[model samples]
Target: MTTLFSTMPSAVAPAPAADQAVQDSSPSLPEMLIAWSARDEALTARSARLPGVAYWLREVAAARTEHERALVRVVNQHGWPSVDLVGDEAATAALRILLHGQDHAFLLRCRDLIAAAVEDGACSQVHLAYVVDWCLVRLAQPQLYATAINPALGRPYPVADPDGLDTRRNEMCLPPLAQELARHQTRRLAS
Candidate 1:
């Protein structure tokens, strides 16, 4: 019964207010974004279904949270849906980091920003549903979009309005719950 909110982030300290100035030669935000997300994805993909996979996932989650803390610091300096967040890859990375986030407030902020980004054709509309669902799950309420998964349970968190789930998922451009469940099963089997 470990909820995502309860299980994530063994501890995520707020990013320090100031750090070494970005070297003019430093990698751009888009590159940084891709690297950050790729690091986590590689870890998760590699750990799939191995013994102590949960341990690996938790480790990844904790490390990812620290990354998010850095993201927050960077974005806060500019803004969410940042002008510097050029390209879909960078934007999508931001969304993925926020999706696994423990901070409900930040998730909501990113949710709204992402929705606006979607309307502006800068971000995927699908991300809006997920950030919203993450917020709901963090509150211990049923998620509307069925995007928040409880990794411990290997299932989505409780979904509200079950009868209309597919409709909502479709509107957000997500696959049907059944389809997603099947996909999850396949991933587990393949793992």
Candidate 2:
């Protein structure tokens, strides 16, 4: 099914070890975003196979650890990068990294930052909704909207109020949950 993972670069080569030094040299916001996007793409591709294979799960876990470390380094070097500072695509890539991140505290901090960015018109409401709902799902709380997906199931997870989910989603400029699920199902069946 198509997901944020679907937008990742499909054929980008893995960065060489020496590239770590280049990354450490304080890359521009767009460069950092591109690097994170590649890492996120690799992690997502690995994670898709994790359910059926132990090896894939290990790879996904390892990639997650590496991704987390890289994100921490980026945040430490520069506060939450925004669309205004970078560009729409780059900031969206950075947001995707935060969405998939394992650090709860860091994700919460990013949520706050993204919320502010949205208020400042530096981010889209649709993206904010995804991040907010994802964080909620991660926290074991009921999501505001069913934007978070169950990768294994290839569909959205259960929501607190299914009947009103579309109303909430509509407010954020997202389509109804049924439409989203159908789209995912269609993509899966096609593949």
Candidate 3:
């Protein structure tokens, strides 16, 4: 299975120190990577039970473009309500276009899917993360939460309408992802 964990950075945060503590000890990009890698085992276990999704994953891996493979991997890893609920082959194809093809209208579609799939709790967090990740990638950015400090401090950002959301250009309201990226940049600048 594609498993959401795979798309995460390979090096996550380090163990907490006995003497060091804070209210928000957010993981750095490297730390996030580590955590993501460790979760690979979880994805492996989950993949075994979802065969159809597995088949799509293989196809995605075999696809000609990086974007196609990335989309397939993402869907496999984070998709919810099961592949059956994602709809028939047509819906899957549409999802592929929305995700990989960089179709913005499809983001709302993906969100709708998420809303239906995840009622609440941890699964919802994962689903939203996936959607946010998709948006970040489409904008040629990095994964969310890797450098995030306070995710709860903001209003929800707006996504472009896919059908009307132009593919010829990039939109705005990427502040959330931008904040994370800026923190990483600032750290590098300081060093």
Candidate 4:
């Protein structure tokens, strides 16, 4: 339920150091990517209660968009990243950024790369599942996995095969959809 695109929280300014980390040669992609994920999570966490925080929200979105650009540059300079190349943490961070990316083609292309990495046992299938689900949601197509959801409704986006959703999700390292939804509901009640 803590997806970047799910809903806006409050606000936190993304530090300029994210770009610096990406541009700096001293820190490898893994190092910079880890920093990027930290910053992005901060922003996402700060985005929880959205009341009279539109300006900060806009700033947050702009920063995230800038993050997408930096990610693109990272991909351009160093081919598709993998656990072997950038490490598991960085690879997961890379996919998280892609989940919020606006470009469908770019997301799809990276999805393919992640899929290959999964086959090689160099990446986590859970992250790849979220990416594929996000890609299909953006395209208005039924997602094979039900990770992508409508935050307002607290329901997953349309699924391709309803009966086999849990099966597909299990293959991708996800809990059954009903269990997932129940967890979300529990969290909501607790909050």
Candidate 5:
């Protein structure tokens, strides 16, 4: 149903021809991030009420596939698009996509980039913690920090030190694990 961009703010302008040219030349990080966000939002909304809708699911999957391809192109052109290159917001959004992506190798590359970005004070530790936890979980290793939440279970994934999770989370500007877990539990109960 509803079009994804129907409610988009009027202030956001359509991409210009020159911007399209740049994207055609190579994957534009900011543009791709924006597209990913729109598609992700659409998928989230539709999936919540129409879980069995194959068409919507296919559309979302196609969008994700496009994002993955664009990510590869961006990486090929430049190791990773830093905040300096794509701006802080776009870089953060790009990192979010990679964190949730299925390609472990690509995620690892993005993780290294995020680490460097954090060192340069270009990105936040909060973002880095998510990717780190996701990578650890993907590798079947315990997460050092409990940043990755298990959506289905409505809780944080397995952590190396549950007791120390909140300490590490606090260092990364994240809320305490107990507090987050409680919030998730509350939401589950409500649902």
Candidate 6:
């Protein structure tokens, strides 16, 4: 039952290089968010051909960027009161439509996964790591998770790396983002 007010662990400061990786050579956040929305609709139309997990994944790919923007928006717009307002279904739906999907069943599955993780004594930090893994598997981001979550934190956080998740730059299934993320991971590992 994590709400917007739930204490999220401290966000790791991005390294300047990682910041450059993010800030350089990407579409505007709004553009990425809108593209994600379109991707979700496309997935929904193709749901019958995709696995439940894959459908679930199409939604995650759609929404990852906007989730961050929405958080920034909530804080900038309403401050503390925004926490109370942020977790509302409508707000969640808007964000999910950007990252995941609008399907109620898919949202329920996400809720269940989060609840199960908490019941397993996974703190928000660890739980987020699990989410990153989940998203990586679904989003097919591969090594992006390793670069995004610092291992020193005991458990990784669930945050996705925006540097790698550009839906528009690529015309079809995952090659561009995958190649870009792989290159980014190689650089991170070499460093």
lDDT of each: 0.71, 0.71, 0.40, 0.75, 0.70, 0.38
Give the local distance difference test score of model 2: 0.71
TM per model? 0.74, 0.77, 0.25, 0.81, 0.76, 0.21
Best first by TM-score, ranked = 4, 2, 5, 1, 3, 6
Flag regions of model 2 displaced more than 4 Å: 1-12, 16-28, 46-52
How well does model 6 score by local distance difference test?
Answer: 0.38
lDDT of 6 by residue, 76-167 (tens): 33331111232333333334442343334343444354444445543232333334444554544553333234334433234355464444
Q: Which of the two, 2 or 4, has more lDDT?
A: 4
Off by over 4 Å in 5: 1-31, 182-191
Mind giving the per-residue lDDT tens digits that candidate 1 earns over 80-146?
6433354677777777767766777777877787777777866776878888888888888999988
Model 2 over residues 1-191: C-alpha lDDT tens digits? 56555465644355322125324334465775666677657655655635575554654565556656666666666666677767778777777767766888888887887788889988788778988888889878889888888866987766888888889999999998889989988866754
Best by TM-score: 4
TM-score attained by model 3: 0.25
Clashes per prediction? 0, 0, 15, 6, 0, 10
Error of 5 at 114 (Å): 1.1
The parts of candidate 3 lying over 4 Å away from their true place are 1-101, 120-124, 136-144, 147-191
Candidate 3 lDDT over 1-191, as tens digits, reads 56775565533232222122212222332232222333332333334445567643443333313333333344444453233333333233333334434346557556666656545431333345546656665565654433212223432234334243222122322234455456656754553
> What CA RMSD would candidate 5 show?
5.9
- Candidate 5 local lDDT, 1-191, one digit each (tens): 56765454533233222223234334455766666655565565566567786766665665566666666667666666677777777777677667656788888888888788889987788888988899999998899788777887776788997778778888998898878789878865764
Against the hidden true structure, what lDDT does model 1 obtain? 0.71
Best-matching candidate per lDDT: 4
